[model samples]
Target chain A: MEPSDEALCQRVAKRDVAAFELLVERYQGRAYRLAWSIVRDPEDARDLSQEAFIRLHESAGSFGGRSKFSTWFYRIVVNLCLDHKRKRRWWKPWAGDAADDQGESFLERQPAPVTDPVDELGREQTMKDLWAAVDRLAPRQRAAVVLQVQEELATYEIAEVLKCSEATVRVHLHRAMNALKKTMKNMEKR
Target chain B: MAKHPETDLVPYLRGELPPAERERVARHLDECPDCRQDTDQLRELLGELSRSIAEPPAVNWARYRAELREKLEARRGRRAWWWQPVPLALATSLAGVLLFVAVWGVGRQVPTAGDPVAFEEAAIGRNLGLLEQYQVVERLDLLEEDLDFMSDLDGLAAGRPG
Candidate 1:
């Protein structure tokens, strides 16, 4: 049987590097995608997600097992991404790192010439416009939305990640969905 | 139809509502065209968002894992060395000594609120008060001179008793 997340955390607390590597392998994709959803930039997402794991390794002893490990880890990842969003202008990806390779925002990246099935769906432009609008949303709204829909976290779990009440999480999701609808409709008209 | 049951949509879609509540929403949806349209829209929005965000970027996971290992190793090297309580304790002791010296030095420059300096100032003020009483002796001397002059004047007025 796979070791429980808490058991792995205990191992990590005991300085078991292999256990930590397992934890990283388990959550790295989720962490990276969550970060990417928020920052919408690949390299920043990678860096921020990596930083979360690094912090987890450093602070593993503090995990008291009161909450789910994934929940605890989610908080770190979201907080880091939200912090990065607040400090820098998402508009200018290359403002600080002039050497940044994937310096474009999600909308600005050049899509492949050939179409994937997802692109073949009537949603290529719709998804683009929606994400562009997501980029425009207030940070809290975007975080709330991503946490709810993409991460599939419940309202209270999202609230835990956001450090707010469940009602506030619901409000954010409602607003994000409404805004995304309006944005997509406007894009369809264009 | 006019009053769409929009409030129930999110929880209903997420299957959060209780069975009774779910049944109620179902009944409402059965009769409500506006709510059905709204639910349809909300579901589509959810689908699009889910699909978009689920799409992965072309990241090399193997490289990511390797780089993280390299960093963690370097970090572990630094942390393991610095985390020895002996060094931390030594640094803390050094800092405490420096702080004590600083505080002690400052205390010497400025006396405590009501200690040595205040008592000395009070003593000096008392001595100065004693010095001011010296002028009272001079006033007594002036009175004696005045009495002598009066006595002489009275003798003269007595038409030179000689």
Candidate 2:
């Protein structure tokens, strides 16, 4: 039988390399995907995910079993990604406009006229628009949506990861959905 | 019509609502076309979000592990180097020396040989006992003079001064 994540985390606290490796192997895919979902950049996701594991290794001993290891670890990754977004947001005004303009033009150039609602459901342009809108959401709101939709975390678990109340998590989801819905309506009009 | 549970729809779609609330929302959805459409739209959007978000590209597990191991080893090596007996001793000694210098430097008021004020202060400190004795001796001399004057007066009274 495989060792549980909690069990492995305890061994990792003791600097058990094998246990740490096992934990990393168990979580790497999920961590990378989760980071990628937030950052939307593969290289940054890989680095951020790796940095998350490094932090885990360093701070494993501080894990007092108050929360599940997964929740604690997710908090670390989410915080790093959010911090990265904030730092990027500072420099974005100078370096971001050209790339964003190009991306917008490219997206606008794509032909996405669908006669049937069912047909629109699977269209590539719709997916792109949906994600583009998701990317544009406030970092916390976007994180909430990703946690709920992609990672399928429960509201309480998301609250734990986001270090916010469950009601706040619900609000984030509500606001994010409203924005995405508005985006969908706009896309439909377009 | 009941209030639209706009806030609860996402949680409802995610099935995170408590059973009673879930049932209530379900019944409401049955009754309200507007809410039902909203729920359906949210559900579709969530579904599309899950389906549309691309998977992270496959990483080489062996390489990933190797790179992480290298980083870990380098970190450990740096820590070990700092803790090695020679370096640790040297660092401790250096820190001790710095602390000693800092304390001594702050507290040091050693008189320089050329500072006249310091020299004078030191000289006065050394003669302090002598100075006190001199004061006592001077008072004793006055007392002796007074004694002589009295003795002269007594001699005059005794007719010895003539």
The model with the greatest lDDT is: 2
Candidate 2 per-residue lDDT over residues A1-190, each given as its tens digit: 9988988999999989899999999998889889998888988988888889989998999888888889989999999999888788677866432233233333444445454434755477678767877776778888998888888899999999999999899888887888778767766775
- The C-alpha lDDT values of all candidates are 0.77, 0.83
Q: Write candidate 2's Cα lDDT for B1-162 as tens digits.
A: 789988888888877899999999999999999998998898888888888876777888788778777777787788897878999999999999999999988875667888999988877776778776897879989999999999999999999953
| CA deviation > 4 Å runs, candidate 1 | A90-122, B1-8, B20-36, B76-83, B104-162
TM-score for the B chain of model 1: 0.51
Q: Per-prediction DockQ, in order? A: 0.28, 0.58
TM-score of 2: 0.74
Q: Compared with the true structure, what per-residue lDDT tens digits does model 1 show for residues A11-61?
A: 998889889989999999999999998888899999999999999988999
Interface RMSD for candidate number 1? 2.2
**Candidate 1 clash pair list:** none
